[model samples]
Target: MIDIIQPPKAKQVLKTLSMHDDDRHDDYFWLNDKENQEVIDYLNSENDYYDAVTSKYKAFENTLFEEMKARIKEDDESVPYKFNGYWYIVKYKKGKDYPIYFRKKDTLENPDELLFDCNVMAEGHDYFKLAGLSVSPDNTMIAFGIDTVGRRNYTLQIKSLITDEIFFDAIESTTGSATWANDNKTIFYTVKDEKTLRSDKVFKHKLGSSTSADTLVFHEEDDTFGVAIYKSKSKKYLIIACYSTLTNEYYTLNADTPDGEFSVFQERVRGLEYSISHYDDQFYIVTNADGAVNFKLMKTPENTTKFNNWTEVIPHREEVLIEDVEIFKDFLVISERSNGLNHIRIKRWDGTEDYYLPFDNETYTAYTATNVEFDTKTLRYGYNSMTTPSSSIDFNMVTKQKTILKEQEVLDSNFNKDNYVSERVWAISTDGTKVPISMVYRKGIKKDGTNPVLLYAYGSYGHTIDPSFSSIRLSLLDRGFVYAIAHVRGGEYLGRMWYEGGKLLQKKNTFTDFIACSKFLIAQNYTSPDHLYALGGSAGGLLVGAVINEAPELYNGVIAAVPFVDVLTTMLDDSIPLTTGEYDEWGNPNDMTYYEYMKSYSPYDNVKKQDYPHILITTGLHDSQVQYWEPAKWVAKLRTYKTDNNNLLLKTNMKAGHGGASGRFEALREDAEEYAFLLNLENITT
Candidate 1:
């Protein structure tokens, strides 16, 4: 047993890791032995201590959870989307933590046929997730994937839609996604390496086939690459793609030809990246080939998809990064980013009507949504901002008309967009990069430095964290807190150049960019350092860990959820799930250059005997992406060196994985806990 504030001091077991002529000592390495009883005991002790520390907020946490949950329509049903011969729908009942998947034929007036009730399946499991729901083309059977252990090793299962019998077919150790061939009986899925958990193989199975008899369709030999299985949008080809952070290679086989051998559409080339979409007799390729760093759209005859055959359809733009494209029978929907804002452009096949979708907010996210039908004149999309609820929309391409299918209903009647103000601002970084910041707050909040502000950023993996509405975020606004998102580098927010500037050797740009944003916010009187806070999850967690290490006096507190703080060790170990494939992302530590560069900012390795801001570190016991030990080891090491008496806490979810809790309502509880941690630090209690 240990005191609430004095966490159980982890017994240090010195372990040396040598690479690229360098040796590093990791004292908390013993925490990595998860199978040992002593290790489990240590984790349990920490959880108990965290529970004890947060016990006083039990009532507040519950209230916050219930308040957020109340904003959700418990009996909500998703708008039906037509596919094949049925209209698919997903609904959640009151008091249920899972969804019931259903479908109806011909009309919404017909009785719904229950496909799967996740609530029942999730019973008795501490963690459960259902995904890869693919109905056969013939609509006779369904293939789905489920994971209960939270490790993301989904078990693929099939059920007879006609006989209503759950088949004995099960494929284990998959990535939780399946693609069906046009034959409806043949299904393909990706499998991960048992040790690294890299999706390295693609397997195909026939209907009612035994798991032992599944055929291995493809195996990716490169440890730096992971594989994925998917069907072309046109439903004509089964696609197998192998990719690393820097490269992409794809192979295709006709969907109707189950036994046919796959042929490469484009051979692998270093620094070349392309994505394929089939339409008519041609394959539209979005590629960064020929030094088009911003990416360009190219079309080639389906029979010859090589580089030489590619003809430019949409030339690359220096300022705009083409993110994605959704193709229809008569239209091409382009998703792009420019000046740190997302825009959706609609261009007709004949190039007669080309225009951008109009949006009012300065910092909102608008992108292509579900568009299953290819022969339609209407386009479906999603739009949301910090002050607006997410909306599902249908835009008529011919008439230029707009119709809102549904806007997420926030049950809180007191919530109003008019009461909030959102805008885009910029922060000049040390290198003169004008970092964009999307901020929101209660309209009447003073621009005086007295306001409390929570600045969030995730600058990694070229994944942009767009500005969107969150019903839960309302609690922070109502409590007089300002929320802002730092559009820093390592993300493709401004363009491809933004991401290139923040990865590999330039990775420090991400941390500095975030720090610059914080300084700008304070200088502008949005909030002073005394009332500032930082928040990020996963890689963003890594961002907070790094930034606070470099600029400890910039914040009052930080909440890092499932953070990847132990960078050097995690990235150097090929046995870790994401290590090998992240070489291009973080750079291969096998090289001395990258090794030394990563050690410069590796949070755990750089922890010094200095004062640190208040930190709340969280992880899940079964996290597959960033293992739980990374954070556990980080917190233990931080406790050993930090001189400050600031509230340092660690909370680990015993049942969840990378994404935390699987249940919808259950996840809200964790959010409430995080919000409560921030609120309590500021002495704000309603």
Candidate 2:
């Protein structure tokens, strides 16, 4: 294995940058056979080291299972009506072919008992479900989404929990997640039209009726993005969040009836980015619209015509970002994050008092209220982390008491979190942009700054990869290696302006920004050229492929999972599923301007005749977003043109879609395999 962070390479990097004057010219051909041979030998050497690391932690899985089993056994509350709980977390257990211990209740351990599970949506079709739950107010009718073959083009289906009968179904171009109206009969959801860029229309479907009974409530002519609607508790004011791709616009709407016309109630809350909550006939919104990282709440009267009712309930918060807001009785429960830690806060309606809930060490990325009635006096909420299985806890807001209610057994006891550590660092980009990077590494590794680093970035599609828990990450982080996520352009970290600045003709900004991040890592003595690996999936995979093509010498290996490598071809192919809707983001390739820009950075079009990093390109066989043949054909063409064959491998998921795997354990195994590949490429722990 090569000791990559030697003092001589830093000077070499400086000399290379100073001597290179042609910025327009591509710099992908620096890799030769000598460099390629060295990388391959290092990978072979690292395999034994990774095996030893795996052997040391094999016993940890058993410990994880025991703890989870104990947690599950302690909770004894069970009800005849299993639908009375907060989360109906139906999942495939390791020992069971059918989803077992799915309901939040104790008695209903098997999903086979649920009458609804017996009904298939279509003939010869298995209803593929994702993360969705029923409204707390009425669990009688469950509003769920079903996607055929995991295309992501879902159909919202309302099933009677009692009778197991399909009440209604509405087809959507994208995700079919919907919110139940106060009456529980109407489901409101947004849909994207295949034709126009900004033709997303919000519709309401009346249950117990045909699809023709559905009515369009709101429509957008401009490619402005609008979703995440929160129906007011009063059922009169419905806040539909509307923001343009290039600008942020917040609106509140007045609904005269359950399925009435929606008129703009409040417009342009300058600093609020559409985070609003309604409690006690009032509106509480968290907005950075005020130029602060934290958020402030705005209160508006129930009446849509009165603009004067719009007032700040909570002034600009300090030191924390309000991650989520929920109405718990007379006060508001806000989940906040500051310096990587999460806290649950309770604020009074009068805005004069505040309190904190006991969630000091509890891990929950998302939390919402459900009408789950448990015998416990406290309010029970669900919480989980990457390593920690999903568990429900009864937390008392008044007394500040918490009790564990239930724990979902998803993984074995061998999963270890102590072996991993997540750290945050800021990298200065080429254009003087400060990029936030998250690194996860093995616990025993010294910051003595010499370790293989796997860098990942997306930097497109206005997607903000929030700091969330992932159990699959343990496979890599426990192996004496480092994993980092680069927050680059086309992401919403700095808001709409940041995303717009990195997209379209400025698409090169994504590539440059990512390169700058990798350079910063090396310059700061975090890692070295030979020990650096880059990994990304989906659009992020596109970023991974482009960076490797632009700077093959920078990384030891590259992993592009379900990547959009054939950008120019996919953008031009109108027959593709999401091609038309994505024109607003990537621009129409038919246009000469977009054609020129895309050709410059599109990975599939830019294969070079030089030694390259060990590339592992992964794609789902049935992926609707990114075609599988894109990676397969790109790798084939790349191998033919490449001077040095540096392990150009493609792993296609035959059983899964874009998400890789349907089951939890299968997903973890795939993640483990990818991480193992990265470790092997970087010669980590060898």
Candidate 3:
């Protein structure tokens, strides 16, 4: 057995926070000063302690990493996607960490044109990401965004595809995407606020012009709103979209008119959420207007885009949630979710034929993928389940023929889909709501209550955690572990109502639902409290933190990755990134009712002296969405308040941001460390 090393104790400088007649004392608030030398020292000390405790199993961690990495086909390439007049493909050479963007003109037999080799571009940077590779309509110029610090603030740059020379025009602090006007020389991009990193302004830039001369096209004056620029799929209009949590407004300009003023599509109405897509002469809208809780599809003439002028194309159904729509010259494809499974429905423009794609899996994810060409009858879609490898398919709407473009290849010779089983089970919450749990395990594993089960969940932001295949997860399944995902509230797993029940005043439902699922697993003999583990990241990290605070005895170990646990404090500070925009999801604490409610369940504020499960927490120093300090302060408080001798470790990625390490192999190492932590607790160190 590895000896537990003494953890670092952060010095507590008493800081008092007051709101709505409530007073809370924070001791580790001093750790929030990222620029302070003492703060850096404390974080480093914690990391050092984590290394010391886990050093005994370092070899095992590397072994787990190699085991996971061996399953990947290293020299992999994404399925070719055709856009404009070129067929574009992203490929990675053997042993390379980054992708090489390639293209072919006219036909697949043509010689490949090298667009960008990211490995060469990322030579000197510790962290690198390429985003928004937009090719001009004329196909000679390309605009892309690059981020080296992982804070998500990308620098926009343009390159001449023919000359292979990068232009002198470089714009900084952008959201990393540029929407080109039909003129090809003019582009519109969004810039973020310096401190908060909120995308608030849209600027128009012309080729060969200094950024100082760029015109501010629009500014989102509301702090709660963010703005982004994009061209419609039809490529007829450039759009500037302004959105808050509950409201959306869009401005459109004809693609040919680069200097023309943009007209608002529809006036913003509170609680009304909508998205727009362009067809031939009309605009297709998917919205939750007129009390359509599940949302419906509507169409309005492009010249007159207003709510009153919109006509219903697809009526809303209570059981079905219209997630997205793809426009084609001859057909319209709608992505929908019913119960907890995704369905793709195809409809011809003349309304002569309409049908849904068949899926046999009880729990799987299917969605539209890279359908950039609007004139084709073939629809590109992706499919995968808990046990099935992902496959990209092209389905013909005319003949109902399907072609598999490429399927994920698990390089392990011993891996087989038949060796594993996946199913969906419902767990009844305290409020009588039936929550779904998607689980997968080895076929021979018995429900003997001795199995180690990892319950994972991300119950926030209306983002559903669908059951998808992961080659790395074979390490656990092959070792007799049952992996499960609790479809809790705060996510749109069951529908919009499920998310509504888990946010704002009802946020506690997200935590309780996860706890209920854990208990249900225990009662079913799939796992016991001694063998059950929990895992979540970001908002999901908030879920596990709140869960352990409510019922720590139920879990043997917990892994919180980049957790947003400092709720009350973060919500009260609007200057923090994403806090103002998140008021609708998590109520603004400036209000008295929200202040009291948030204080009641805030993970850091509610830490008490009690025996807790072994915990491993991770954070990235440059994380912009959830600042590094939130997790740092959380770990400090957990160490101070918890009375258990169980392992409590904090591992911070000093150079990376919220997404963690940049290289594919480096990411596997982090995952291996996490799995090692859990396995070490079970004493499975082999």
Candidate 3 TM-score, C-alpha based: 0.99
Give the alpha-carbon lDDT of every model. 0.90, 0.60, 0.93
TM per model? Answer: 0.98, 0.71, 0.99
Question: For residues 45-147, could you state the per-residue lDDT of candidate 2 as single tens digits?
Answer: 3333334434433344334333333323222322122333533544333332223323434444544335233123233543254434455246566666666
By lDDT, the candidates rank as 3, 1, 2
Query: What lDDT is obtained when candidate 2 is compared to the true structure?
Result: 0.60
Scanning candidate 3 in windows of ten residues, the lowest lDDT window is 1-10
Q: In model 3, what is the error at residue 240, expressed in angstroms?
A: 0.9
Number of the predicted model whose TM-score against the real structure is largest: 3
- Judge candidate 1 against the unseen true structure and give its global Cα lDDT, from 0 to 1: 0.90
Name the better of 1 and 3 by lDDT. Answer: 3
Cα deviation at 356, candidate 1, in Å, is: 1.6
List CA RMSD, all candidates: 1.5, 9.8, 0.9
Q: What is the lDDT of residue 477 in candidate 1?
A: 92
